[model samples]
Target: MNILDDLKLQYKLGGIALKMIYWNVACFLVSLVFFYSFKVGVFDFPSWIALSSEPAVFVLKPWTFLSYAFFHDGFLHLFFNMMVLNFSSYLFLTFFSSKQYLGLYILSAIFAGVIFVLGFNLMHYSGAIIGASAAIMAILVAVTTYSPLMNVRLLLVGNVKLWHVTAVILILDLMQFRLENSGGHISHLAGAFFGFVYIKLLQNGIDMSKILSIVLDFFTNIFKKPATPFKKVHKNYQKPAERPVSKIVVKDKKQQQIDEILDKISQSGYDSLSQEEKEFLFQAGK
Candidate 1:
């Protein structure tokens, strides 16, 4: 197959984070070609797709809030965002479904874009923005908040707590707030806030992932399902024989406790689990 076919196949097989990173990289390449050949800046490629910080322009084209997260101005801007996104995706998918991750990423990006525009307008700042930084930040912070004590080994830092890494990143964002690209920093924090809140609400038994489920359902239902054919039967047709229910259906208390511990490991990492719980899971897996 040709390169295009190979790319399509790769995209089909990859998870949400890889798909997102691929899209951003593709957009960047397309934008570069157009910039060199057509004299259009990265953010000025087309009004309907690229995002602008100007309130008047944004009011006219609201979809840019979501679209803007797919393009980057420079290589480093794209590289760092994609790296964090890859790491965050591995950690996030350990506990959450891919659908939930897609929802959180989209929701966080939209919220960050809108907040950036509003904040920029209020401060009379005149600058355009485009990148996946906000969404990447959200994923990183969200996973960290859920499992703060998780241990991660670094090349030079040995093993550090998850919360420690998150705190360092947050501090850098805060420190850069007054130095340069303050609006970008604000958008990052907005995404971070959304991530933290999304997980907290989930722990309370309120799932926000349903928002993306609705969106997916709408798109998938674009072609309606064929209706069932009408059936005809005799007036006194007898019903089919019923099957007996199984004697053992639901799991007992021990099984239930084991399932809970397993879920906890998925969320907070195995190290956060007690020794007893770890041994139980190990034995059960065997």
Candidate 2:
């Protein structure tokens, strides 16, 4: 089979995280197509302008917060993000439900975008933040929270627990906070914090899925109508028919026999049973 067909098969069999990675990879390819077709001018579209300034120009442009996560500026940026997304998503889908998995992904992206905006505005960083590092950090934090002691065996590096891996990543982000791509690192930290906090809140029974539901309800209400009261239906009364005396008497006797049998079974173990008794017990439970 061709490589594209292989990827499609793998994607069909893969869990939620893998599917998301596939989606991000597809978006990256599409962005590349746009980049080359536009003579590499797409990458030069000021990240800050695309993310922050443009939204003010058009209210519908707020979706860039979520869309920007899938847009990478270069091949290296796309490759590392997809690698991290695939690994992290596999770990996430191993435990969480698909809905929870997606909720976390979107929430992480929004949190990352907010942090990126904050850094850009407050710190005056004109550079644009791209890639799935923030979302990957969120997944890492979530997996670590769920199974802190779960060992991940790395090639040549042997095994390490999830908590240690998260710690190292967090430390690296902290130490490199002032680097050229500091905004992206800050966004990663935000996503990581959100992942950890989200898991903790889940343990306490605060479902974040309800937030998505609320958003859905808001949009649905716009196009839907309110329910109207329905009048209750009434039926004409009719007389009942009578049963035969012999049939009624036989049914009462059978009920009494069944009750006695049940009482005997309650006093004795089911192992002390006759064929008739077994059938009676089975029918009674049913």
Q: What is the C-alpha lDDT of each candidate?
A: 0.80, 0.73
Which candidate comes out best when scored by lDDT?
1
Model number with the top TM-score: 1
lDDT of 2 by residue, 139-159 (tens): 889988988998888779889
Question: How well does each candidate superpose onto the true structure, as a TM-score?
Answer: 0.74, 0.68
lDDT of 1 by residue, 1-286 (tens): 3446445644654578778788889998987766434444333557666677876788899999998888877778888888888888888888898888998999999999988988888988877677888888888888998998989876689999978888898899999998998878988999999899999998999778788889889988887787899998668767978765453333466688877986785588555777576556555554
Which residue runs of candidate 2 sit more than 4 Å off their true CA positions?
1-6, 36-42, 45-50, 53-60, 213-286
Which residue pairs in candidate 2 have backbone atoms (N, alpha carbon, C) closer than 3 angstroms, thus clashing? none
Clashing residue pair totals per candidate (backbone < 3 A): 0, 0
Clashing pairs for model 1 are none
> In candidate 1, residue 74 scores what lDDT?
74
